[model samples]
Target: MKRAHFIYLLLLWCIPMMGIAQIVPENPSSGALQSVQNLQVSDVPNDAGDEINISWDFPDDLDKSQITEIRIYRSTSASGPFRQIDAFPLVLDSYTDADDDETGHIVTPKDTYYYKIGLFNGSEEVTSQVSEGVSPQISFFNWGRLNVFIILGIYFALILYFIRASRKGREIYIRTLPGLEALEESVGRATEMGKPVLYMPGIDEANNIQTLYSMVILRYVTQLVAEYETPLIVTVGKAFVVPLAEETVRQGYMDAGRPDLYNQDIVRYYSDEQFAAAAGVSGVILREKPATNIYLGSFYAESLILAETGFLTGSIQIAGTGNIHQLPFFVVACDYTLIGEEFYAASAYLSEDPKLLGPLKAADWMKILAVGFIGVGAVLETFGIDLFPRLLQI
Candidate 1:
């Protein structure tokens, strides 16, 4: 009788605890942050490495006092019973997976990792839905060769079309603009001034698309200068650009059949410091007093200082910069200013090089497509309709 009573009492005592464990409060509010959103991932570059970066928007109510830590969970399957692999103190809302490897949490390339991020409030844990899997894939197409082929095809097509159009006696009318007229006069002024022509390629590394555009423009400018027998002074900021610029100027001289007139001293590399570079170029402007000054490439605050100095020297300045903030100064000072896309379009416009021009035309088509999408979206939104973004994805 005594043993039966004791067992019964023990069972009675444990039942409530078990019940409590099973019962999770519905819509329980915690002092800690509540939500996470906007997760994204991309492959790490320059290696045979498979990695994904994750970032998220934290809850508005998030505070240090409420949350103690964030627990990160990962799973191979999207619909997963995810396993917790890492935990971070709730000091920062963002965390990178790269730091988790030291803790023996190993991720292999063969397996795709989907992540679930959760916040550990003092009493309750709130978790977000698992993010989409990041999987790596390789392409069979040789992109390098394909790119070259595409460029050549476009070039040949444009040349043939232009030739045929000319033979048919079609008026090939192109719109006239002030900037276009200035190019010829700028070169002419340089020839008559008995001073060197100065070209400052904007201070940016080679990887920048703007710098590449600047180089293309330089080719045409150098050719014109070489033909005129005008001394051209080219100052570049990057070490990498120095060799490429030298080759481009050399080719331009060769094309003009005045290779003997081409001088190495004309193309010089200046310091990379923003202010220091501007100061050095200014000194060259002051001493050489070039009749025409061409400033092209990406520029920052130094744009005004350079333009002002060039203006004071009475050089017929033609400036082009994709930097929108610096455009105002260039517009006020430069005799010819190529705005935004015009600066990018300058090389193709001058050379009529189809390899470059084809891409520019394609980009314009893309803009039209984008504008059409925006118009449709606006119409839907005005009618209180939501155009689901997901359905558009392949």
Candidate 2:
């Protein structure tokens, strides 16, 4: 009887162990790796370009201890005979393609690449479904003759709509009192005082949207200065923007038919150091005593110092920055400021170019749709009804 009782106790302990093994299955079921969650890609920085980062989370049934290695594969086609490009020892749940120590792959604009990850445990392997093909999207306006017709068609339609709207006398709800208006007055004041008008394109490359927008506004402002035969000085902090700003200013003068009045020396490049650039611009303001100062672009901590110095110099300051934190300082010191999207809209507003205005109007209409949807959703929820609750499920 004693021997039998001991044997029963042993069986009871073993039963729990057996159940544990069954509950935590040693091998995952087929199609266990169905969900590929948290996939993200972003442009890589500080390179000649044409590089992107790809990363994803591991499968749900993934056994961290059993995973010996992870295999990475790449394919040009989505349904592909994927070729193994990289293999990493399972140290973490995620892997970054660009940072891998192995032979790095250089991406080309012409080729679209898809990625697949495989988790290996000795002989057994679980492969992830292939990622969607990723290729560089060519800008519609930049691409050759193939896209020219599409671009022209868009512009033509916008022009026709603007003309029709004008004829119909439609009341467009455009708000008055933009911040850049003060900059215009500042430029006019500088022209009268015989002092230069100073403009700074933010300290970033041409690829930066903020820098591009700054140049666009600069074009319009320079044209005004040219008409007044005023001296306009543009100091850029980035080497790439130097030539672009010069071209923009030169083109503006040419368009004004006063190329002779354009001063090449005024549009210059300064040191790329954030604080040093601020100091240099301060020196320019103090020495040159510019009657009007315009700061439009992506600015950091240096924005306040620049604006404050320009303010002290008795120059009419107009600042526009996409940086949310800097907006406060610009507001406190600058006479007029373009906040966020308003800065981008300046070119469209000044030129009254229909090509730009149509998109702006369309965007406003989309915003109205968004606000209406939000309001309707709130009302529905208050009444304990969900119009599209299934959308929140995934």
Separately for all candidates shown, the number of backbone clashes (residues 3 or more apart, or on different chains) is 0, 1
Per-residue error for 57 in candidate 2, Å, reads 16
Whole-structure CA lDDT of model 2: 0.76
- Name every residue pair that clashes in candidate 1: none
The Cα RMSD in angstroms, rounded to one decimal, for candidate 1 relative to the true structure is 9.6
List model 1 lDDT by residue over 94-127, tens digit each: 6556524556655556778798888777678878
- What is the per-residue lDDT of model 2 for residues 305-355, given as tens digits with 9 covering 90 to 100? 989999999988888878888999999988888888788778777877555
- Model 1: residues with Cα > 4 Å off, grouped in runs: 1-67, 70-85, 91-105, 109-173, 353-361, 388-394
Maximum-TM-score candidate: 1
RMSD of each: 9.6, 9.5
Candidate 1 accuracy as TM-score? 0.65
By TM-score, how accurate is candidate 2?
0.61
Weakest lDDT window of 10 consecutive positions for candidate 1: 42-51
Pairs that collide in candidate 2 are: 179-337
